[model samples]
Target: MSDAKLQSVLSSLSQVARQLEAVPSGRPAPDASCVKLNTNENPFPLPTIIMQSAIAALERQYLYPEDDNISLREAAANAYGVSNDQVIAGNGSSELLGLIYRAFLAPGDSVAMMSPGFSFNRKLAMSQGAQFLEIGWGEAHSLPIEQLLSGPAKDAKFILLANPNNPTGTFVPVADIERLLAQSDRLIVLDEAYVDFAPDNGLRLIDHYSNLLVLRTFSKSYAAAGVRVGFGFGHPEIIGRLRNIQNVFNMNVIGHAVGISVLAHRAAYAENHKHIKHERQRVTLALLQLGFSVIPSHANFLLAHVPAEQDGSWWQAALERQKILVAFFPDKGLQNHIRISIGTKEQMDAFLAAARDISGSLKMPSARRWAASGSASALRGR
Candidate 1:
């Protein structure tokens, strides 16, 4: 193929086709023997009911899944007090994100998103031939509520807000979002992927705001990442529109059955959820005491900003040398941070031990940043 011919062929491709790239870090699954905290996956075993249900569904694999998403959808609706019409299911939250772009974003339309957030959102916008206006947060890691309500972001067709956001693991409060909604007309996408571990969530606000759409996934909390179940809630009109664009058979037989089983017996998993919350507290304190600039997180991960003097890449390389993996970012805003997922207490203890060994110091760094700056308490007295 001549260079000009190849260039022409590429130019003929759709914007999405031309811009799509391989997934960065590609979902962070660590080795089984490795104390895996790289992915924000539930470190516990699947509930017995979910296990039995998925296994039983194996017999039905000979046939296509019933488009009957009823049981799972209804379980989610009942959990959030919405009617089934107000809900839609997807292969994962990523698919639902694409569906939202498909429904609302015209080619070249703009979106508003934050830097150091779920970077996947930026890629999603690019894939849909949409542009994004970014609002970057500093070390303080405050939500850009005032900025989002300002002129720069007011005209976007939609906005992607990841609460208990990814990578940075910071949160925008529910009341703050309510205030933003009153001032803005753009569709607000509240990605609550990690909200299961947070103190508050967006499930209850869907009934109040016509433009708000909240997305959830079984990947992180339900211990069903392998089953690929994700869903969205909103005003019926928006959900109905997403339904029109979604594949009727988007979910598979085994995954459908598994999702139904998981949501139906959600209470059974509460203990693991509580354990993660507790461990997150312990991990944050450990990081803080070590002089790592930790952003207090409400998600299943913590974003520990390595001091500029210490070098994040070096720390990551050191951990990898010890066969422990974590999510590392080369993006400028997050280049100095590594996202540590909340794992079993044993796994967390292993991580702290590895981190200490890597540091090679008997005395840890003082909380110079947190104390002198008056930012906030780590976990002590909170």
Candidate 2:
């Protein structure tokens, strides 16, 4: 190929490279050196049984993983009380999101998602040359079901709703979801990646709504994010379409083995879920006691609104200096807020101490900025 021709092809990737480069490298390391609260991973280690199963798969390193990953699929199906044909596993929930977009979205086809939501959905839609419609979910971060149900864009090709949405940790009620499902003719991709931490799950609604597709990951509650195992449940026909576009061997042998083992021994994962939920509530109350406005969350993370004048730049830097890391987004709607993932109680105590210290050091000018910015209204509860 001529040099000009190669340059023309590579030019399209420049935007992608810039986007990736723009991601902040503020996360704490996972080793003993860092407090590590940036990523929403489980602080606890995987159960002994899962570790054993993964080790056993090591003995069969020479062989390729099963093409169908039937055993893993069966386990997931049973866990969700669905037929095996309805379950489709992937490297992680992130991969499954990409697969669904590629399988269903065509150039110019529109995908509607809530704004200030997970950044992945927007990026994925754009990558496929699809029109991404981001409607701002109200300050509470709940889906604008009424607007979506009656809007001109109701017929969009796909709608991705994150139950107990990431970062904000807000969720739409089941009744609201039912309304959306009843009115939506297009596919509704309900991302339940953090559903295990929510008090209620959307799995029961799957059989009732053929247009609904629920995606889940073993990362949070199962402590398997590193293993990269995730799955989706939907109508068998939709599952078939996804399978057609999927890689032949999406789940590796060890991932499949560990996934199955984790599902088989649910007690440990269940206990972890309970512990995280309890901690989430405790942390929410503690933040509130500290005078920070917190969005009520049903997920593993809490989005607490900090003072805008508090020098978010300095606040984040100070936390890092104290070895406490949390997530900060640039969206104006989330600028004064920090998303903290729930870890052990001891970890949370340390995080609280860091926040207290930082709050004490913030100048009055910063406090005035926060007051002028309507921080209270931004985090008003439902």
Q: State every prediction's TM-score relative to the real structure.
A: 0.87, 0.87
- Model 2 Cα lDDT, one tens digit per residue, 162-245: 887887788878778888888778788889988877767788888999999999998887889899999999999998889888
- Model-by-model lDDT, in order? 0.81, 0.81
For candidate 1, what's the RMSD? 7.0
User: Model 1, which residues run further than 4 Å from truth?
Assistant: 1-8, 21-32, 137-140, 361-382
lDDT for 19 in candidate 2 is: 42
Candidate 2: TM-score? 0.87
